[model samples]
Target: MIIAVVDGMGGGIGSQIVSSLRDELPSYVEIYALGTNSIATSAMMKSHANKGATGENAICVSSKKANVIIGPMSIVIPNSMMGEVTCRMSEAISDSEALKILLPLIPEDFELVGLENKPLILLIKDAVKLMKKEFNIK
Candidate 1:
């Protein structure tokens, strides 16, 4: 299956997600790194994503092709990531046919109620676990 890991800014979260997925999933499962900037894409590529693309159009096009999309919750928030995620990018991702698994990392201006502030690593692990369950991966 093709899994897309989307991220922005420094891409620290996406890199971690990609690295964890590389460790947990079969090698044949393609990982597409979709970054909002070149630096973000480069970071994810270093984490060993099978393919990498940057910018809005890349994200929009790749989202549709992905079987699953995993990223921070801000991915669906227009003008999030300090404006790195545009409205069209968020819309494309939100509208994509792929199953989305978003980590609850929101921007400072936004707040989500009733969720524990877990460490990023734990969140990534939980996301990966859910992905395994959803795709029936061992």
Candidate 2:
């Protein structure tokens, strides 16, 4: 299956996701790094994604192709990531057929309720577990 890891800004979150997925998921699964900028894409690529793409158009097209989409919740919010995420980029990801696994790692303004404050590593492990469960990966 193809999993898209999308991110913006410095791409630290996306890179972590890619690295963990590489270590946990089967070698057959494909990981696509989709970033709002080249810097973000490069960061994820360094984590060993099968492929990488950048900018709004790449994100829109890649989100459509992936079987799963993983990233910060900000990917679905227009004008997010300090204005790097555009309206079209958000819309494409939100509208994609892929199963979305979004991390609640946003600013105070977008804080989610009913979620315990967990470290990023813990949250990423949880996300990886969900992926394994959904994909029936051992």
Per-model TM-score on C-alpha atoms: 0.98, 0.98
What TM-score does candidate 2 get on C-alpha atoms?
A: 0.98
lDDT of each: 0.97, 0.94
Q: Can you tell me which runs of candidate 2 are displaced by over 4 Å?
A: none
* lDDT string, candidate 2, 40-79, tens digits: 9999999999999999999999889999999999999999
Candidate 2: lDDT of 63?
A: 88
Candidate 1 residue pairs in clash (backbone atoms < 3 Å)? none
> In candidate 1, which residue ranges exceed 4 Å CA deviation?
none
lDDT (Cα, 0-100) at 74 in candidate 1: 98
